[model samples]
Target: MKRIAIVLAAMLVTAAVPVGAVTAQQSSAESSAYAGTHVSFDASENAVTNYTVDGETVLQSVSTSSQANAGIGLDIALSAVTDIDASALSLGTTTETSATVQADSGATLNAHDNPKGTLVIAAGDESQYVTANLSGESKAEQVDDSRVVVENDNRTGTFIVVGDGEVTVNEEGNVSADLAEDSRLVFRSYDGERTAEDERSEELIANGSAAAEVYVMQENGSTVADTVTYDEQTTVETTSDAKDNVTMTIDRSVHEGTIVMTTVSEEALAATDNLSVTVDGEAAVEAESYSELQSAANGGDNSAYLVQETSADAESNVYVAVNHFSEREVSMTNDDSSTTDSTTADDETTSSSTNAPGFGIGVSVVALAGAALFARRRA
Candidate 1:
């Protein structure tokens, strides 16, 4: 049986109601930088009643299922501004950048500034879960299996669900999931004209650029998704071994899942000839399309990757997906003969490079463990 734990910070509890009843009490917190954005919580009911951004309501309400064994955990370290008997909610020194609410069952809902201007809501629990209800006229679209896009009156946001559970977006625009232990649900708001392109765009922007990125999906319904920006835990090294040739080697802990490599460089786009990838010292098989590559990766084939040229854009994104992890190397050479072939072919085939790398477009079948990492360029 799955149990739900709700942890609240610094609050006492006394009032008890029947199961599934909306709590009579509520608490609100405001974002300091974004003047009109705020979130309200129903402490007793263990639900977020309202969440607004820039004075516009984006979320109507968010509540856990009735099957949850609700309990509140309070953080006693921070100073509390308001106090109520039998209430399980706390507003501890709420700042413009951060706010937190936890329950005794280890469930937590946190709001913070992710990219300085954007508001991010992160909810996670080893035992509890919650479902979100979109506000008026808002619609939800599933970008992929793990991501959903929410469009409101004039703003857009994304939900990044990381776990072994299934995420569903109903016709009514409601979002729910059956999260496994160590699961996480992250919501980030994009105000004005900043729209979410796809799932990978959010991950890429959040994790930034690194030499290599590893996403590990464990078997226990938990994920270890993070970006390797430097050679701290994962080591990534790039070298030009030969003239007009480049090679990158990534070293990290060996894990039993898929490894994806993405590059958005004009040089890579122009020199898409003689691309080769190897994993665990074995040559990888190139898939004809992104879908085929995804199928091969999920099929447990440890030696599968994709390399293709769709157009002639200034910057093109390329993805290479492989099963398993360890020391892997990717080599690309700008052969003069291949260049001539490309030039002659370009004269015959008038194809423009407008499609970006299909990041998160049914790319990987497993859950992401860590942040998205990009390779550093050699100047």
Candidate 2:
């Protein structure tokens, strides 16, 4: 299911972008920060110590748009980060810790669970690691030339330095994290950061140790966008062996990150535990689709209508459309659209707003465990 969604998203992106063809905008994007930076795994195989002793070094500035110098453990070092982007990453496991990560003065390293035992991240003179399902202390430190490392010698470890942005993790899910704002990142449990030691926090969210968390980090005055429609159909199925509180959280801090769009949901089998799909600590965008996105109906048709726009006053706008239905109807459409002019938190629930708890979409379903497993395989 996760792979399918990824393919679907890629197809949509390809459709939106001409293949092997570059317009002035596309050509400019190549020189833009979020061009195309990939994660590298080779450094994960070259595990070593001295990272803790020397520590990850941060330099002055780096330009991701010019070089697109991306890969795990690129031995990078920089002071100011202008334009950069990433897809997905993770570190180590419970037993054999490792990582695929990046570290910079101003970058978000979104790491996820990597059962492969090692993940290495390097950005702007810093190198780090990521791990999954580990059970011991690992080491992290920076060396000269902005090189850092997480020694997965006796246990698992993950490392990185995240600037202001959002990181996400989900307990039960198959997804292609969507980053639709500048410098914003969407990641799984493997996401982490290496700050200057002033801003620090850590969390591991998932159903079991085998799972991973997701992340979405954004820099100030940045925007990251993905193909996620605010209101869309989604399906989540867990295997028979899946258990415990399955939850996901989008964590944001210090940096003024913003989330301006989102409108997809699956009412059946949504995220267990509390779910925060977006966390913007600073600025933000409007919900790109229907605020009240209704994607699934009675396990039948999965469809949603979306409208995108911004208010005139530069204020945020939330376009709401609920999914009300009559079972007798064959072809259906949204009966109404509820628009909220000014939303208040006290009179309502906490939103996926400015690092608040993630707003929930869809619903949670609890059935027999065996059946759930079957559903996952089918999904």
Candidate 3:
């Protein structure tokens, strides 16, 4: 009996060793610092427990959690800041300027410019899989399905959460969503230099300085319009028309840089095989790539190029690069008229009772006979 007990004890101890090792591995933490800023990542919690600037605690703790079949949960605590937190599944790399964390379910958290103090959280799997809790003096307002604006009472900074998912911010400023992959939430620290009001009021379709923006114009005038500021040198207003033939207009009077425009059509656009772009009513020349477009635009030539087209949804999206912008309109040429004409032609061809061609010939023959009879009578 004693020998049997010893053998069982040995088996139990061996089984316990691997569990303890995994626990230690999951509990490990990583730290990095840059430009008077410091960040610490806790692997066990999959969170940032400390985010400090100039030795002042700007963030207390940012943690993540998950439930069965759910994406991820995020909870943040700010020191002399707002209460916003995020939770993920695991901790990734930690660098001086940034730290990354990811969830097994594909949610990702990225803190960039830790020295400058910016945090951006994104969905990895294109699923609306991230939920955030907002507390303290912070107030969150939902701008649209893809945008949420969080502001604190002191107005020291602003957090903009954008994704292709349904974003909800209650009166308490808590944010929750099952965000699609690549959807992002960004936090920008103004350090009391700028107020939340300084941010544009329009629905932010995209911020050129931060990331790409996608806008879809419907038949109704209710389309997305935004002011995009690039490189701090150019501000452009983007708007679209409500017609079947959608027209995207960019006010590039004060623009400077290469602008990329991508479009998808249900059918082939009129007059242009790939994509159409016009500046001041003149067709702009096409370049080979975005780099070429940028070079041409910066070198005083208006140029454009079709980069790619994919025929996935019966038609492909066309990517165009342009170097200059001036009274610019990006659209399908006569899209509505072409569709109408094609439909009309199809209907005419299928109508057996109309006999349009025969009717035309009969009318012509009658007119000629009447003219000949009148001439003979006169003679």
Quantify all predictions' global Cα lDDT against the true fold: 0.44, 0.23, 0.43
Q: What is the TM-score (0 to 1) of candidate 3?
A: 0.39
The TM-scores of all predictions, comma-separated, are 0.39, 0.18, 0.39
Give per-residue CA lDDT, model 3, range 109-217, as digits (tens): 6665332255566655445334444435555666565555655443334445454545556434455554455655555443344433235311222343222222232
Candidate 2 local lDDT, residue 62: 15
Judge candidate 3 at residue 368 and give its lDDT: 53
**TM-score between candidate 1 and the true structure:** 0.39
Ranking by TM-score: 1, 3, 2
Output the better candidate (1/3) by lDDT: 1
Relative to the true structure, candidate 2 reaches a TM of 0.18
Instruction: Select the stronger candidate by TM-score from 1 and 2.
Output: 1
Provide the clashing-pair count of each candidate structure. Answer: 28, 103, 20
On the 0 to 100 scale, the lDDT of residue 185 in model 2 is: 22
